[model samples]
Every structure is written in structure tokens, then in C-alpha cells.
Target chain A: MLSKKQARAFFLGGTVVTFLIFIGLTIFSLSKGQDQTNHEGITEQVVRGKVLWEENNCMGCHTILGEGAYYAPELTKVLDRRGEGYVKAVLMSPVPWNPNGRQMVAYGFTKEEADDLIAFFDWIGGIDLNGFDTVVSPLAKDKIERQTKN
Target chain B: MKYKSQKVAYWFFAFSMLLLVLQITYGFIMGFARIGFDGLHEFIPFNTARAVHTNLLVVWLLSGFMGAAYYIIPEEAQRELVSVKWAYVQLISLAVVGVAAVIGYHFNWWEGRKFLEIPRQLDYLVVVNVLLFLGLILATLFKGKRKTTTALVLTMGLLFAALLYLPGMLPFDSQVTDSFFRWWVVHLWVEGVWELIMGGILSFLLIKLTGVDREVIEKWLYVIVGLTFLSGILGTGHHYYYIGVNNIWLIVGGIFSALEPLAFLAMALFAVNMYRKGEKKHPNKIALFWTLGSAIVSFVGAGLLGFAHTLPQTNLYTHGTLVTAMHGHLAFWGAYAMIVLAIISYALPNMTGRKLYDSSVGRAAFWMANVGMIGMTVAFGVAGVAQVYLERKFKMDFMEVQAEISIHFVVLILCATLFTVGIIMYIMDFIKHGKPTDEELDLESDL
Candidate 1:
């Protein structure tokens, strides 16, 4: 039963509200510091694992350093969170516990390959972006670098 | 031999229903996998099943729509289809190509894009769509009747759909450019062109069912089509925001995509208003269910949920998450699936001269489907929000977060199970109990 003017007014009001929400979120995101890491050089095993990662197209599901599909979790920080041993263990666990009793068939990796993957993950965990936000559009690469220097 | 148009429509409608059953089964299995990951590798892995579920949905809905267009276009033009044989050819080719594509997907041969994963073997599917589009255009033109606004809008929508792949086919070296064009296919098809098509078809069905003045329905159709293209084309900008695009895309995409919902809301209002004005007393309650249900659900699913994450700020958290899946499941169902169902309901009795076997049973199935869809949407939507919090805001250990949200997975499984049951009931009722009476056959002559 709204008149044309009333509908227009209602739409304008809604737009303003959405705009404000967007601005608030943008500001909040800018405030959060970028995550960084500090670690040592990669080994031969780690290098081999990196190649496997590409060949298998793991990035199709799992993101690393916020640069892949969101279907799976980020693996860049995996080593820091779970340590090398736990990483290998989870990789080798053919039947990980499913709380809802629905079966997830495990892709069982070889023991040596699992260790190499852990090493590669550990290498990725050590990259230091110096707390400049990395989740924004890749076009903001320069701005991120500037922020890091400041 | 007689009523060839109706016969073709019903046959394809039946095919669509069969595909719907398979898609729902896959949907349930995928839902269960979300809850428990123990038996994913059996025959249909999660990714494989998900691809099949989504692709089959697209195929079945499009087939039904093709059938509906063939049947309704001629009737609205007050002439027989210009070439019924051509229509049959189009259907046969589309079905053959569609089935081949689906089989390829089941065997894990895909193009790797989520919804665009039809294998190279079915690359000719687009050619088939183009042929059908041309057939429809020719039929409307040769009828010698002036094109109604509804027919014009539907034709334009089909034209856009045929041309949608242009950007995707551009020889772009950069992945980002390719991705941007991909959204042109995805976003424009669903948001822009599909909305117009749905508007046109909805108006046609409402007019036929309610015996309303064609002018009134056509006017509503015009407004909806205008809003659809105006809001939809620009709204593709929203998806461009995250994919290595400039910041201006954020503003353009966010603003326009946010406005896209208003057009859908307006369409819903128009339909309700028409129903109120019409003289027919619940002529076909099943058609009304689909018509009204589609309008309402599309507004909420495609429009609201689309706006929820249209902003670049929100997109950062919700992109590629289950939130996106929730939007997709409901939007496709509301916008495409329900419209096709409406067409089926409207045409079935006409084609068969059968009174719906049991009106109450059909109505009951409608409620069950609606309720089940709402339940699924709510469950998945909340789960998506929880996922955003766990992954983006809190940045918790990923596996721990997954373990905590296993309950949401269980809820999703339950909702999907309920939806599957409703689908089964509807299909059973349609097949076993749907027979028309002699009086209904006599009513067609009144047209």
C-alpha cells in the first residue's frame, strides 16, 4: 500500500543503513594486523612436498596464506598450530573421528610423503609479512607493502 | 498425435522429475558427508556428488523451461507452434547432450569450475540452447500477432542467455580476466537474464490460471524485466570485488547487487496483487503454490542472501564458505526449480485432460517442500555464520573449529532428509494419483 514517494524513501533509508554497515566493517578489517611468521630454510623433503601440492591441486580446496579455495582450511599456519608430529599423524589417520558418525574416507599418504608435507608446511609457516593485511584484494599489494614498512 | 505441444511438455516434465529425484538423492548424500566423513570414497565422493547435484539441477530446470516455452509461447500468441518437429528435435538433442554431460561428471571428467563443470563432450549443449532460442524467436515472430511485453521480455532473456558465454570465450591470457568473464556467465545468467525469464513465464502462468486481463500481467512483467536487467547486469560487479579487481568494482558491485533484491520483492508484490484481482477461484492451487512460493523464496534466497555478502567487507568472510552454498541451494531452487514446477503443474492437467488426482495431497506436498526448504536454509545459513566466526574473526585452529561445527552438519543432514521425503511424496502423488476428468478436457475448448 506504499505510495511511490514512500517506497523511494524506504529504499533510500535502507541503502544508507547498508552503506554505513559496509563502512564500519571496512574500518574494522583495516584495524586488524596481518599475520606473519619467523622460521628457517626449507629442506629437500619440503621442496618435494611442495611439488606434490601443485600436482595434486590441493589449492583447489585448501587455502595457503589466504590464497585458495575456502572449501578446506588454510595450511600456512598448520605447523604453528599443530606441530610437525601432529601434522603427519593427521595426514596418516585413515579414519579421523567424525563426531556425527558420518564416514569420511581417508586419503592415506605414505609415511615419508607425510613427513615431507609437514616440513613444507613448516616452511610456509615461517614467512614474515610483517603484519600487513594479506586478505584484501591482490591489487592492494603495494598498499600492504607500504603498511608493512610503516 | 493430437495436443502434440502438451504431450511434449509432459514428457519432458516427467524427465525433469526423474532428474530431480537423482539430484535430491545426491544432495542428501552430500549433506550426510558434511556430518560424517567416513564413507565418502565409496562411489560418489563429496566433490563428485556436489558437482552432479548442481549440474543436474541446472539441466533439469532448463529442460522443463524449454518445454514450457514451447507450449506456452504458441498459446499466448494464439497460434500453433510454427514448427513442432523442430521443437522435438531441440528436446531430443538437448536431452542426449545433457545426459552425456551428466555421465561424464559422474565419472569425474569436468572443467573444474563449480557450476560450469560440464565436460568438453557436452560443449555442444550451448549450441542446442541456441537452436531452441532461435526456434522460440521464430515461432513468436511468425505467429503474426504483435509480441506482448511478456513474450518480448522472455525472448530478450533468452537472447542474453545465449550470448552470456561471449565474455567467457574471449581470448584472455590472464586468469583474473578469465575469472571475471566467468562471473559474466554465472552472475548474469542467474541474476539478470533468468529473472527476466522467470518474470515472463510467471506472468503467463498467472494469466492462464487466473483468467486475469493479459494487459495487467504484461505490465507487471515489463516492470520486473526492466528491474532485472537494470539491476542484474551491474550487480555482476559484486563478484568481481574479490577476484583481483579494482576497488571501484567494490562500490559498483555492492551498490547494484544490494538493489537487485528490490526488483524481486516488487515481482512478488505484483504477483500477489494479480492473484487478489483475478476472478478464478483457486483454479489450480498447485500452480499458485509454485508461483507464490517461487516469488517469495527467490526474494529471500537470491536477493537477501545475495545482499548479505555482496559487500566486499562481508565477502571477505563469507566467500567460498558454506554461506555461499546456502545462497546457491535456495536461490537456484527458488528462481529456477519452482518456476519449472509451476509450469509442470499448469500443463499437466491440460495435457492429460486429468483433474489432479488429489488436490489436498498436492497441497500437503507443497507445504512439506516449503517447510523443508526453510528448514534447510536456516540450518545452513546459521552454520555459515558460525563458520565465518570460527575461521575469520576468531582464527581458531581449523580442525577444532570443524569438530565444533559438526552439529551444524548433522542439522543439515536432517533438513535434507526432510526435503528428500517431501520430494518423494510429491513425485509419488504426481505419478500415481494425477488423472484428469472428462470435464477438465471440455474446459480447454472454452479457451
Candidate 2:
């Protein structure tokens, strides 16, 4: 029979050990040497784009990096899927962009704002997603084929 | 009620009920929107609805947990709350912050980080509100004659929950780093500290209802929470995998997440065994139903269903689809939501001096809610598995796949209506009990 004191010790000791290891793993993953996050690739335009993405709450409808409301399309590889021109038109359009009858809120963003978002998408599209990129956006497969042919 | 200050918990429970109704309303909006009846699109867009639904859940559950602490602490500690006035202040401030954030979400005044959407400015106020809450709780616990394990664990859970919120607020330019830390708050709270809160409350309820020995119940409480952190801390890696982090998370998250169900299994077994061992049957049958149901349902919902999609291989296909939604709905319902309702069911009769235990309406509420939620889960599960096949595996267009599965939302809406009826009845029973009375204090000994 395990005593109360032992149970308490097990709780405290296990919490401390696992939490310490979690911290170590976080540091190891985020360190520049092992970094796969493309931290240095974040330019001023990309930063502005990220800001616009959050400001508009694009994630409310659209998923980027496979995290969001699942209400709209996943935009992790939006640049590769939809060309910059189509994306910009939708962003700058004065009316709600309803594709296949599902409506998107109309922001009527300026050209600069649209460009910044596109830049953000471009940056997001460039990251290595450990094969998730291949699965999520079929157009990524197309883009790879195009690159190989060229 | 042992202490007069325990009467304060009724008001919090009342507040929780109010928020819960509002939360369900927004949930219906999203469900309708899914099936193409999005008439509120211009006013309450899908994203706005999503933010409100999730944030309200966090708020209502927090309110319930705070109410549970307020009610349980005084009894377990053998003293009244340190300051009832300050506790009311905390409650009012929480409502203010919660209301302000929900309204802000409507006006595009949010940070837009999924669950942590409250703007940076409001985050500071939340910190203040929680700090005030913890101050009262901790003061009461320490000032009392006794500091039982149940009180300490619950307080510890609340304290760690507040600390974890800080990580989500930290600024990060990299989306990867930002999301990585976001899980520190979100994942850790649900899987780690919140389980501590749940265990504490479970032990308290079992002690009272089961007539089991306090030492035995509290000792099992320690083992369950110990199991919770043991698997849950490393289990944060499950979120880390495929979020642009290292591959180590794939292995770490997979193994730990598989072990996660063991904790819930322990909880279910403990609760059932305690019931079997109990010689005394306190007459609060509704509370017992919810308590035992919470344990069993959580094992199936949070534990097994979560295991259904948490593997790296399966998650790769079901990552952002309706599959996650399927698991999340039941997990929150079974684990957090039912426990909150259990405490409310148990405390209400005692607080108001209205022993309306074993009402037909109460029993109906229990069955309707559970059956309705199970129906909703099945609807979501079918929609999710279909989504994984058509969209992820077959590479169908997203909108095309949605059109194929919109029928599930119709089923979801029907089941949700049934669930709502159950909740309405529960609230009706709550109202019939009326307010907590000072006269009830010291009326009877502990059950």
C-alpha cells in the first residue's frame, strides 16, 4: 500500500522532472543551430504581413500552419496555391469575397496592406513543414513539378 | 454550509449559468453557419463566433472553478473566506473583463491568436483579476485551522494556471515560437494544472458523498494528479509536432500522449471504487450521477477519443480538420463542464437550504444532456472521419468536401437543441432553489 507521503512525493517529484525536461527540449528546438523555424528570414515586410494577419484575425476563418477555426481554407501554402495577383484582388476587393458561396469579410485593404500579407504568405510558404506541406496543399506538388521541369 | 462566506459561491454559479447560455448561443451560430444558414455573417462572422465560443468556455469554466474553490476551501480549511467583499469585487471584475473581451471580438479589437484572443491591453486586467482571486483563496486557506491536501491541490492548480497564462502573453516574432509557448498556457492548463483542480474537487465530493475515509480519498487524489502531470507535461509535445518544431516532438508526443489515457482510467476507477466502497449514500443523486458520469465519460471522451487522433501518423491527416473538433467537444464537456455542473448540483441544495435532491427534472436534465452530447459527438465524428477521407486523403477541394458533409451540421444542430433543453431545465431547477441563505449556515453537520 502506497502511503500518502509517497503519493505526494510522486506527484511533486514527477512534476519537477518532466517540467525540467520540457524546458530543456524547448531550448534545444529553438536554438539557432537546430532551428528549422526560419527565424532570420523574417524581414520587415514579413513582419508587417504578420501584423496584418493578426490585425484582421485571418486565423479566425483561415488556418495558417494548420491551426485555426477550420471554417475557411488552410493558408499555410496560400502563395503556392493561389498566385499573388488573385490573393491581392481578394484582399483589395471592396465587397465580401464569396467563393463557392462561403463569405469572407471584406476589408478592402490598400495595395500596401495586400502586399504585406502576400509577403507574409510567401514567407510562410517557404518554411519546411516536415512533409505536412506535401500533404496539405496539393498545389505544392504542382509547384515542385514545375520547378523540376524548369 | 459550514461558513457564511460559502453563500458567495451561489452568485458565481449563477454567473456561470448565464455565460454558459451565451456560449451555447454562439455555438449554434457556428453550427448554422456551417450548414449555410449564416445569416449573421455580417454581424457575427464565423471567426468572431469562434473566438466568442472558445473564450466564453474558458471564462465559464474558470468561473465554475473559482466558485468551486470558494465553496470547497472554507469547508476544507475550517474557516470562512478571508474577505467576502474582495471576493465579490473579483467576481464583478471578471465579468467586466469577460464582457469587454467578447464585445471587443465583435469589433475586430482582438489579438486573433485562436483561444488567447483577448488583446494585449486586456491581458493585464485579467492578471489583476486572477491575482485578486488567488489572494483571497490563499489567504483563507493559510488563515484556517486546517490546510487539507484537497485545499492545497486546488489552490496549487489555480496558482499554476495563473502563472501559465503569462507564457501565452509573451511576444514572439516567429509564429512557431508564439504557438509553442501558447501551448504552455492552453495545453498545460487543460492537461496539467486543471486536472489538479479537478482531482481536488473530486476528492472533496467523494469524501462528502461516499462517506469514504478522507485519508483514503485524498491519497488517491494525489496519485491521480501525480499521474496527470507525469504524462501530461511531456504530452505537450503532441502539439509541438508538425508546428515547425524539431522531429523529437513526434516521438516524444506520440509515446506520452498514448500514456495520457492511463490517468483518466485511474480517475474513473477511483471514482467508481469509492462509490462501491461507500457505506453511506448522501441523497444528492443528481450530483453523484454527474460525478460518476464525469469520470466515465472523460475516460471515453478525453482519454480514448483523444487517443483516436493524437498519433503522429493519424494527426498528419486530421490535424486541422473537423476531427480535432470532434475530440475537443467531448473532452471539454466530460472533463471540465460536467465537473462544474456537479459541484453546482451538489452545492446548490446545501447553500439554499432547499433539499430538492432527486427531482425528475434534474434526472431528465442529466439524461438529455448526456444523450444529446453523445449524439452530437457521433455527428461530429462521422463528419470528421468523412472530412479526413475526402479532403486530406482523396485531395478534394475544401469547399467541395464541406458541401459533402454539411448534413452532419444539421444533425449537430438537432442534437444541440436537445442538449440546450437539458441545460434550460437545470437552470430552472437552479432558479427554484433561489439564493443562498445565511440561515442555512451551521444548520447541519457534514454529510
Candidate 3:
């Protein structure tokens, strides 16, 4: 029979060992050499656009990088799927953009803000999402591939 | 109740219940919105509703955990809490922070991060409030006559939970990095330390209700929590698989995530075996139901359903779809929510000196809530599977897929209504117990 002391040791030892490994893995993955996150692409416009995204809580509705409320479309590949012009138009629209009857809160953003958001989308669209982009947004993938072929 | 200070737990439980009701209301709003009843869209948009719903779940569960600590720590330590006055202050501040966060969500004053959207300002207040809470709990435990394993584990869990919250507060310019650390708080708390808390509470409850030997229960408690951290710590990789992280997570997460169910399975088996071995069955049938239900349901909900989509291959499709929600709702309900409710059910009678332990109302509440929740899970699973097929596999338009699957939301709403009725009855039972009376202090031994 396992004693209480041994059980406690098992708990403590498992916790410490696994925690160290988790930390090591985190460091390894985030290191610059292993960087798939495209951290350098985050320009001033992209930062401001991210600020806008956060301020409006756009993630409440839309998912980016496959994380969100699942209420709205995933915006990770929005620039590829909709093109910059349509995205810009939607952002700058004075009224709620209800293209499919699901109303998006109308911010009526200035063109500069819209441009910044577009830049953010462009940056996000460029990241290597380990095939998630190709899987989730096949249409956008097709569009990008077609454009490259052109 | 063992001590006058334990009476303070009643107020915390009351506040937790209040927040739970509000959380369910926000849930209904989102559910209704899903099925095209977006009348509240102008006021409470889907995003706002979602933030409120998730944040409120976190708050209510935290409040309940605090209440459980307040109730259990004093008893396990065989002493009154260190400072009842400070405990109340902590409770009030927690409620204040919770209310402020919910109200802020409505006004769009949030950090826009899912689950961690309480804004940086309120996050500071939360830290202060939690620190005060830990100080009181730790002081009581250390100053007591004897230190029990249950008390230490519970305190450790609380302490670690507070420490984990700091990672979520760290700023990161890269969204991927931000998300990676966000799981450090959310995933670690739920899958790791929170299980310790759950184990502590379960050990306490089993000792009291099952008349089981404390040594036996505490031994298994250690084993259960050991299994939790062993698998759960590296299981954090499951979230990193496609989130712009290294492929290392795919292998690490897949193996660890598969092993994750073993913890819940151990938990369930431990609880059932303890019950069968128990010679003295305490009269608190409702609490027993919840305790046992929490173990079994969590195994099925958190363990099995989670495994259904945890693999990187499957998660590639179901990553952000309704499948995650399907697992999330049941997992939180079975694991955290039910445990909190079980402790409350067990403590209320002792605190208020009203032994409404085996009431029909309580029994009804138990069955209705469980059945309703299972129904809701099924609805979500069907919707999510259909979504994975039409949207991901078949490459249908997102909106088109939503329209096709909106019927599941209708089913979800119906099941949720039943679940709400169960909660309302439980509240009614709670009200019947009235307020905790200091006169009942140390009158009847907890066992």
C-alpha cells in the first residue's frame, strides 16, 4: 500500500518536473530562431490596428488565430478573402455592417484607422499558422495562390 | 458549523449564487442571439454578452472557491478563521470588482482579451483582493493546532492560482506570445492547481460524509492531484498546436492531452470507491449527489469530450468552432461548478442550523440540472460536429453553416431553461435555510 508520504512526494515531484519542462518548452518555442509568429512584421500601423481591435473587443465576435467567441467570421485571413478595399469599406461604414443580417457594431472609423486595421490584417495574414490558415480558410488560400499564379 | 467565523462563508456563498444567476442570464442572451433573436444587439451585443458571460463564470467560481476555503479551512484547521472582519472585506472587494468588470464590459471598457478581459486596472484590484484572501486563509491554517494535508493542499492551490494570474497580466506585443502566456493562467488554473483545490474539497467532504478514514482519503487526494499536474502541465501545449507556436507542441500536447483524462478518471474512481467503502453515510444526500455527480460527470465531460477534440489532427478543424464551447460548458460545469455547489449544499445546513438536507426540492434540482446540462452538451456536440462537417470539411460559408446549425441553439435554449429552473430551485432551498446564525457555532460537530 502506498503511504501518505509517498503520495505527497508523487504530487510534489510530478508538479516540479512537469512545470520545469513546460517552462523550457515555452522558452524554446518563443526563441527568435524558432519564431514563426512574425514578430518583426508588427509595425507601428499594425500596433495601432491591434489597439483598435482590442479597444473595440473585436474578438468578442470575430476570431483571429482561431481564438474568439465564434460568433463572427475568423479575421485571420480577412485581407486575403475580402481584399483591402472591402475590409476598408466595412470599417469606415457609418451604419452597422449587416451584410448577412448579423449586425457588426458600427464604429465609422476614419480612413487612417481603417488603413491601420488593414495593415494589421495584412500582418496577421502573413504569419505561418502551421496549416491552420489553409485548413480553416481554404477559399482565402485559393485566392492567394491564384493571385501568385497570376 | 465548527466556529463562529464559519458563518462568514454563508455570505460568500450567497454572493456567489447571485453572480451565478447573472451569468446564466448573460448566457441566455447569447443563446437567444445565436438563434436570430438579436433584439438586445443594440444594447448587449454578442461580444459584450460573451465577455460578461465568461468573466462572470470566472468570478462566481472564484467566489465559490473562496467560500469553500472559508468554510473548509477553518474546520480542517480546527480553529476559527484568523480574521472574520478581513474576510468580509475581501468578499465585498471581490463583489465590487466583479460588478465593476461586468458593468465595464457593457460600456466596452475592456482589454479585449477573451477570459482575461477584466482590464489592467481592475486586474490590480483583483490581485489585492486575492492577496488579502490568501493572507487570511494562510494565517488561519498556520496558526491552527495541527496542519492537515487537506488544508495545505487547498492553500497551495489558492496560492498557486494567484501566482498564475500574474502571467496573464504580462504585456506582449505579439498576439501569439500573448495567447501563449494567457494559457499559462487559464489552462494551468483549471487543469492544474484547480484540481488540487477540487481534491482538497473532495477529501474534506468524503471524510465528513463517507465517515472514511482521513488518512485514506488524503492519500488518494495526493495521488489524484499528482496525476493532474503530471499530465496537465505539459497538456498546456494542446492550446499551442496551431497558434503559431513550434511543432513541438503538437507532439507534446497530443501525448499529454491524451493522458489528461487519466486524472479525471482517477478522480471519479476515487470518489466512487470512497462512497462504497464508507460505513457511515451522512444524511446530506444532495451534497453527496453533487459530489459524486461532479466526479463522474467531469470524467465524461472534461475527460472524454475534451479528448474527442484535443488531438491536433482533429483540433485542426474544430479549433474555434462550437466544438470548443461544447467541451467548455460541460467541463466547467461538471468540474468546477458542481464542486462549488456540492460544498455549498453541504455547508448551508450546518451554517444556518436548518437541516433541509434530503429535501425533494434539492433532489429535483440535482437531477434537473444534470439532465439539462447533458442535454445542452448533446445539442452543442451535434451543432459542433455538423459545423465541423459543413464548414470545415465541406468548405461551406461560415454564415451558411451557422444558418444550417441554428436549430441546435434552439435546442440549447430549451435545455438551458430546464437547467435554470434547477438552479432557481436550488436557490429557493438556499433561501429556506435563511442566513447563517452565529448561535449555531460549534453546536453540532460537522460529522
Candidate 4:
């Protein structure tokens, strides 16, 4: 037996509160996340490589920061796993590495371009991402203990 | 068509149908490509096809929403539309912009953003076109005799949706920053404001088709709106969990998003209860079916299926998998797409002065589309679970995992065929309704 006036008031109040929560969480997350993603800071090469990555639509296949197609392997941690030289060789010739038809197109990058990409991968590799999956998240107990000590 | 200007909705609907055909064509191309049939790989690659398919689906839905607003506002406001000519102009501009963006995608002339791929330059055109649309609707509503809650909610949704698009357009050098604001548009629109639009349309159809008192239905509308905000606003956190965001979002997103289903569940119950309480005097059986179907199915698709992976635990392995595609197809179909079809089904006969309601084709369209979509959801769910296990859990190669799940896409294509057939029949019936007439303007309310 909800009356129209009651319904209106209820909706208006609930909406304002919900909006506040969303905004609060977004600001909090953005402050923490942006700091973490750029912790290593961007170099000229990293910036140029990011542009090249976008221009060639590298994200069309590989995910950087876990936000692209699932067709290919992740590139965010490539520098850690494959090293700079390995990344350079793969970019120079992608078919030998991913030749199962779902392969990267031949980008024909110059040496400087490959070096820039390597720098970009190196930058992202340092980002914690706080472990995008929950599997590697710092335990709640550890966080609580640290906060209490602080 | 209580107002002569309401005839403009016809063209918007016709345009939406045209885009729908193109959307399905792209869907078929991608579906075939999933199974090693890479005939169009050289020119229309999977990424390009995927972008075109998703973008067309979005535009068509927006066009449908705009049409619904044009048709509903004049009638609810009890006035002629402020400007019918401008509405036609808006439609043509929308089509031109859509075609330009689609063409640009082929030659790599667009932004690489997944859904927001219409290059920043064209985003300005979209903003201008939507402004014209909002101006007309707002002007007509203000000039009309009565301003109902139904009308206001729909208008608010459209206004907020337009405002939210600005955040996505802002330049950001950080990928995380770009994605953060992208969700402001994507997550907020679908989960937040769009629900308001759906509620308004559902309320209108329930009023007309169920013969319910307006007071009763609008009361439920308030509740649905309340619940939508209460849950859906925070529910955006579900996406924030694994996108290089704060770890706190994992807990917040899990709890709030899990509650998001309650809103859809409430809508389902509200529509069903209203139908039970009211006398069915309007006699548009097909429209009623779609109205009730959208309500119930949205709960299953957007609510139940969404909850399946909303928890951080499940989403850890399932994020961006076909599980998302599963929830996406169903939620869009059940919530937005079905509501558009319902409103069109309800409005067509009224506008054209026809009563072709209980035809075999219309009923078949309702059942086949629903069944086909449910089948597709099941297929995606199966494939998604398998992908999560094989790739995420076992560390298998991405290509090998995709190959193992290729068989499920076979099921997806078969069901998509049936869904396509149902849509074709719906278009046939739309054509059969012909065009709105001035003669029908003076007709009595069915209620």
C-alpha cells in the first residue's frame, strides 16, 4: 500500500544516496589506480610506443592492462616474461611466434619503433595492477593489520 | 497517433529496422569467423566486424528509444509535437553519421575504443544531433497540457544519457583514466539511466495493454526507479573490480551488483501483478506478450545471468570471456531490444488505424525470438565456462582454448537464425501496419 507521494519521496532519497556512493567510490578508485598505473612514470619512448600501439590497433589482438580482445596473449607483462630483446624480435617478425592463423599483422616497425614498444612494455610491467584477478590480491587481514599499525 | 506529428516516429522505426538488418549481417560474419570460416578475414577482419556489429546494435537501439520517445511524448503530453520537420531532419542526420562511422571503420579512420569507436571528431556530430532531439522533446512536453511521471522519467533518462556521453569524450592520456570515464557512459547508461527509460516504456504499455489504472502503474514505476538507483548505481563497481582499479572495489562491486537483480525482479513482478489485477480490455495480445516478456526475461537475462559472474570470485576467471557475451546478448535483448519491439507492436496499429493484433506472424515472432535468444544465452554460457576452465584455470594457449569452444558457436549460429527469422516477421508486420493517418488522430482511446 505505497502511496504516490511516499513512492516519490522514497525514490528521490534513495537515488541521491546511491549517486553519492558511486561518485565516492569512483574518485577513490581513480586516485589510487592512476597513481599505481603510472608509478614508473612515462618516458618519451613509452609515450611514443603507446601512440604506435593505438595507431596499429595492437589492442585488437593483445590486451594491455587487461582491456582488449582475448584473441592473443597479454602484453602488459611481456617485458617480465620474454625480456626486451624477445619482445623486439617478436615485433620484428610476428608470424614465427603466433603463426596459427590468429596472428598479428606484419607491422614492419623501424628499430627505434621496436625500442619504443619495448620501453612501453617495460613501463607497464612495473605496474602492480594490484593483481587484476582476486587470486593474487593482498589478503584483507594483512591490509587491516597494516592500517591498525599505522 | 493522437498527434499528427507522431507520424515522424514511423521513419525513425523504419531506419532502426534497416540498421538491424545490417547488425545481424555483421553478427553472422563474426559468428562464422569464430568457427574457422575466415572468408572475410582480409577485408572485414574479426575486430572490424565486431565493432561494426556492436555499434550498429547500439545505434539501432538508440534510434528505437528516440522513436519511442517521439511516439509516447506527444500522446502523454496531450499536444501535437512541437516540430515534426526537425524530427525528420534528426533521423536523416543520424543515419548519415552512422553510415560515415561504419565506412570509416573499414579504413582505420576511427578511434580504437571498443564501443565508443566513432572517432572523437564524429562524437561532436552525435552530440549536436542529440541536442536537437532533446530540444524537440523538451519543448513539446512543456507545451502540452499534462506532464505525467511516465513522461518525466523517460525525458530524464534521455537527458542524463546525453549528459553522460560527455565524460567518455574527454581526452585522457592514462589508459586507466580513459577506461574509468568510459564506464561512466557505458555502465551508467545501461545499468542506471536506461533502466529509467525502460521503466517508462513498460509503464506506458502496461497502462494501455493491461487496462490498469494510471495511478497504480505509476506508483509501481516509482518503486522500480527507486530500486534501480539503489542497486544499479553502485552496480557499476562490478566492472571496476579488475580494470586496474582499487582493490576495495572487489568487495563493494560484489555486494552491490549482487543486489542489482532485485530491481529487475521487482519489475517482473510489477508487470505480472498489474496484468493480473487489470481487465484486458485493450485487446492487443501481441503487445501484451512483448511487454510481459520483456519484464520477465530481463530479470532472467540482466538479473540472474548478470549475478552469475558479478561476484569477484567468479569474474576473476570469467571476465571478458564469452560469459560476458552471454549476459550481454540476453540483457540487451531482454531489456532494451524487446521493450522497443513491444512499444512498436503497441503503437503501430494505433498510428495506422489498424487492428491486426492477433495475427499468426506476430505471435510466432514473439515466441521464436524469445526461445531463440534463450538458446543463444545457453550456448554462450557453456562456451564461457569451458573457456574459463581451459584457459584461465589450466593455462592453455588462447588459440587452443578457442578451438575447443568453437563447437558452441555452431549452436549460437543456429539459434541466431531463428532470432533473425522472428525479427523479419516483426518487420513484415510493421510494413503491414502502413503509415500513420490524420484520420486516426481523432479516434477514441482504446482504454
Error of 1 at B9 (Å): 1.0
lDDT of 3 by residue, B59-126 (tens): 99889999999999988888999999999999999989999999999998999988899989999999
Per-residue lDDT tens digits of candidate 1, residues B1-447? 123444556667777899999888778766666655536446676656766787788778877777776666666565566666666677777778777876775565666554666654466566665667566556665663566666666666777677775555543333334455667688778987778779878988778767788876776666566666666666777775654444556676778888889888988888788888888755677878888888888888888888888877788667656687778778887888888888777777666665573477787777778778878888878887897787566655455666677797788777777777777777776686354333343325523
Tens digit per residue, CA lDDT, model 1, A1-150: 444344434434543554465445434322324112221255677667765554344544455544444445666566544457777776777874232343333557789888777877766655542221243222234444566899
Sorted into a CAPRI-style docking class, model 4 comes out as acceptable
Better of 3 and 4 by lDDT: 3
A5-110, model 3: which lDDT tens digit per residue?
9999999999899989998998999999999868889999988998899888999999999999988988999888988899999999999888567888888999
TM-score of chain B of 3: 0.99
Look at candidate 3 and tell me the lDDT of residue B442. 72
TM-score per candidate: 0.78, 0.99, 0.99, 0.93
Residues A1-150, candidate 4, lDDT per residue (tens digit)? 789989998899999998998888777777744466764477888878776776666666566666666556667666644467877887887443544655455666889999988887777666656565322221322444566899
TM-score of chain B of each: 0.93, 0.99, 0.99, 0.98
Global lDDT of model 3: 0.92
Model 2 RMSD vs true structure: 1.0
lDDT of 4 by residue, B1-447 (tens): 677888888778888899998999998988887887868776787767877888999899999999999999998999989998899999999999999999988877667766787877889999999999999999999999999999999999999999999998987666667777888898889988999999999998998888888998999899898999888888888877776777787888898899999999999999999999987757788998999999999999999999999998888767767788899999999999999999988888888988888899999989888898899999999998998888666666567888899999999999999999998998898899988887887646653
Model 1 stretches with alpha carbons more than 4 Å out: A1-71, A74-150, B1-3, B37-42, B144-146, B169-173, B433-447
Off by over 4 Å in 2: none
Candidate 3's TM-score: 0.99
Write model 2 residue lDDT over B166-253, tens digit each, in one string.
9999888888888899999999999899999998888899999999999999999999999999999999988987778888999989
